[model samples]
Target: MTKRNKLVFAICAVIIGIIAGMVFVFFNQEDLINEDEAKAIVTERYGGSVEAVEEGADDDIYIVNVEGDTGTHKITINRHDSSVEAIETIAKPSEDTAADDSNTSQEQNEGTENDEPSEPEKTEDESDTAPSKKEEPAESNEPEILTVEQAENAAANEVGGNNVYSTWSGEGQNREYYILQIVDGDDEGALVSLNGVTGQVNKVVYLDVSDDDYGNIEQLIYEANTYADMVDGRYIEFDDEYFDEEEDDDYEDDED
Candidate 1:
């Protein structure tokens, strides 16, 4: 053969081979499976025997259809491990099934009716005979209000904020409580607690003291005026009255 003709024939053969290979792959793109493993997967998912209607390739996924008591399900198994990846139910219960359920319910109702004893109906006159009067609900008791002195004492004792603190009593949630204010050298804040009660400081929190002079007990009383409005009364008391007495001894030594 001529060189040109031989080259053309070789090229044609290569093209035909490529086309055939493509067609084979397109048609055989399903996973190949073992018969025993396929059956096991179906038994595990649906509790029934599975039939392989079609064979799949090595790389493709195997699809199996399982028939159950209620419906037919489609399950896909992996060719490599025989593990079930997906399952879908295909059949639905028919109208005759629904009608049978209704009939069963009706029979049960009829049986219950025959077993139960019916009570005699009362006449209109019996219902009309004297309706009993319902007693009114008792009035709710008001919470006791705290005295001004009691509120002041409670605020001075709670442990928080500054060394020097003051207290004021007020009414909240229908209950009497005391608001405590503390003033350290730099930090100033306040707390609220129930009057004469331990550990109930829900309402009042610490107040920020921006002014240095306001740390005095008198200023805390003025700032806590709002708490005073809610209470029976308000008052201010010093936390450290003996500080001056203690300083007097030191002052006498300086003179010596």
Candidate 2:
């Protein structure tokens, strides 16, 4: 062949090779596990009812929604390997209702008990010419903020985690509190926020370490620290209607 024809032939051979490699990859790529398989894997691992399973942002990932006894969880699964990537807690069972019921019962029991009023007392020197003295005002009653250890304990009580990976204690915009990173094993964990004054749980958010590069423990602790720095120790009830109000208004405007 002539030099020019030989060069063209070489170029065409390289292009064909590239096209063949692409075809092989497109046909032989690893197959992803189905939605039912993903649900079974999550249900077996997390011991919850799999409410729904949806495709994730990536083609090889699945997001499984589960409702456990303690809370609702959003579990991420790697469909190719059938591995759990992350578990995010969307909701925890409310303790306020139970607390209120107990308080009411205690108040009712106390109300049934009768108390006797004390009689007035007179001193022997009441008639004496002693000068009357001004009484000092009562000391101010204030709630005491809990220590770091107490805050950690409070968090542990709310979430049944055997290990506390990390703890951050500081005063936020509204109150003083502690945020703790807790985990059961390598995969499951939570970031717990405890009230410093009341020793009550403020929030319990599940850890999502799917994108963590440093490892689960390190990333979880880092997340706890970041959350502690940003939390203002304020609890606000989340309502879906609140978010849709603007959308509803726009729809009404369109009708008019």
Candidate 3:
């Protein structure tokens, strides 16, 4: 073969190889995400540091462990689409009972230390001149109030919800109530208020699913829970009774 023809044939072979390489990459490239990306996604959604990320049973799925504000949870993500598939709570944060006790003790100690300096021993004439005062009768002790857990249970029982997103205790102008943001397995969410002392459900305001243009119930729950955080100011109050007759029926059944 002529030298020029040989060179041209070699050039054509190289071009074919380059085209085959490009086609292989286009077909075989999967949009698989990495561990760092999984961590970022989880942190953004859950607001916590990602502890670890591991491969799931399937190559396209990743399980990310996160220590979030609410609890330690494992978030499952689809690596291909970078979508969160499931979030399972491993454990909820425990109440800092020790810290509360310490604070109470500190306050008591401060009160004791801050007692007013004893007035110089009053002279006999001064003591005699002090206006005679009658001691007021001692006040009676109040009844024990319901605990947070009991309040949550009462609210959940009334609403048929299983998951509690947040809870707050406050005294409004009219009454003292425990407010809870709860959601059922079906993504139905509601804000519930109940009497703190009596454990009676006072009101329930369900999330407006009809107007959920975003179609993300979990996000909706997060937004709805912010209402409970506004304890210092006014909140949604309801005077109408909520599921009281049903509670009465349950009590009757228990007695039977």
On a 0 to 100 scale, what is the lDDT of residue 92 in model 1? 56
Candidate 2 lDDT tens digits, 1-256: 8999999999999999999999886764546788888888988887969888899776779999998767789999997788888989998857885677689989887777635455667676864655778899988676566767777677777776654454454554345454544355554556666666777676666654333523555545554545545556443222224325767999999999
Q: In model 3, which runs have C-alpha deviations exceeding 4 angstroms?
A: 1-30, 97-256
Candidate with better TM-score, 1 vs 2: 2
Ranking by lDDT: 2, 3, 1
Q: After superposition, how far is residue 58 of candidate 3 from its true place, in Å?
A: 2.1
Give the Cα lDDT of each candidate: 0.60, 0.68, 0.68
- Summed over model 1, clashes come to 8
* Residue pairs with backbone atoms closer than 3 Å in model 2 (clashes): none
Give the clash count for each candidate. 8, 0, 0
Predictions: Cα RMSD each? 21.0, 48.1, 39.0
- How well is each residue in 1-256 modelled by candidate 1, as lDDT tens digits? 9999999999999999999999887665444456666777678867855645444564456678777556677787786667777888877557787788889999999999999998878789987885879999998685445555556555556544433444444444445454545545564556454533333444454455556645575555454544444445223223322345657988999999
Position 49, candidate 1: lDDT: 51
Task: Kindly list the per-residue Cα lDDT of model 3 for residues 1-256, writing each as its tens digit.
Answer: 9999999999999999999999886664446887888888888877888888999886778999998557789999998789999989998866785567678999999999889686688899998999988989898576567766777677778776664444554544334444444364443456666666777665565653433424554454345445444433333432122335657899999999
Scanning candidate 3 in windows of ten residues, the lowest lDDT window is 233-242
Q: Lowest summed-lDDT stretch of 10 residues in model 1? A: 233-242
Give the CA lDDT, 0 to 100, for residue 206 in model 1: 48
